[model samples]
Target: MEINIASGLLAALGHESRLAIFRLLVEAGPDGINASGIGEKMGMAPATLSFHLSHLSRVGLIEGKREHRFIHYSANFAVMDELIAFLTRNCCQGIGCLPKSFACNTPEGTSSQHGETC
Candidate 1:
């Protein structure tokens, strides 16, 4: 992940609404969720949700596919994984720094529990 691309993704997630939307999509997994479902779950107005979704999509953090009249959104896991790899590439200066019991069992780009990439 180049700095510019990473910066763009980070900027898109910088907004509270966008972050929430991304997290929600991650939780929804590969199946994804439609725009209306996202708005309903997040208690956001359609316009507000649309704006955030557009930003996220533009940054390649999320993707949308048309299914009937609804557009289902899901996280772009490849980009997400690259971002995580970039961020942690220098962890502990290439030395094992975490505790011995600390196992990063989390999926490539997601949280430990349900696979939510940071």
Candidate 2:
């Protein structure tokens, strides 16, 4: 969760295509989706999908595992969790100014209760 690491993650996701790819992978969950499936689902060419996938993998946002001839990509949930915690670490300034219902949503769209810090 260092600044450089967080910055790299954010920068990698800054692009529209990469963001979409990441979102799709996040939605795919731990089992992930293969390269062909990702490209097909996103309507992206193989080369374009490869580029985005490489970038995401380089930044540690996504991980690729070889499953026979295909490579399955899944979001790195640990890194994602760290990034989320880092972003929301200072929320409410420790004074609880936000409502009690205020919570941070993980990549899976599930709400995580935040006591004082994320």
Candidate 3:
């Protein structure tokens, strides 16, 4: 991701409400949850949730689709991965750097005993 885009995402996540909203969506996975479900789970007002969701969607961290009468929100895993990769890309850039394999590089469909796959 470009620095400006990364910065925008970081800034959007800097807020507590936004972070919470993002996490909730992340935990919900690609299938996602609806706005009202999110508000109920987080105990937030509809207007407040709408504001937070807009910021997250603007940053490409979350995606929303209108499903019948409701809008469902899901975390954008690809963007999230890009942000993570960018942040950790130069973790050990200089001499005696850790091997590239030391960095996280999990493949899809790799099952985790914890019932989560990253």
Clashing pairs in 2: none
Preferred candidate (lDDT higher): 2 or 3: 2
lDDT of 1 by residue, 6-90 (tens): 8888888888889999999989998999999999999999998998899899889999999999999999988989998988888
| TM-score for all models, in order of appearance | 0.82, 0.81, 0.79
Deviation in angstroms for 73 in model 2? 0.6
lDDT score of model 3? 0.85
- Between prediction 1 and prediction 2, the one with superior TM-score is 1
Candidate 3 deviant stretches above 4 angstroms: 94-118
Worst 10 residues of 2 by lDDT: 109-118
Local distance difference test scores for all models: 0.85, 0.86, 0.85
lDDT tens digits, residues 10-115, model 2? 9998999999999998999999999999999999998999999999999899999998998999999999999989987887886644453454334544344444
Higher-ranked by TM-score: 1 or 3: 1
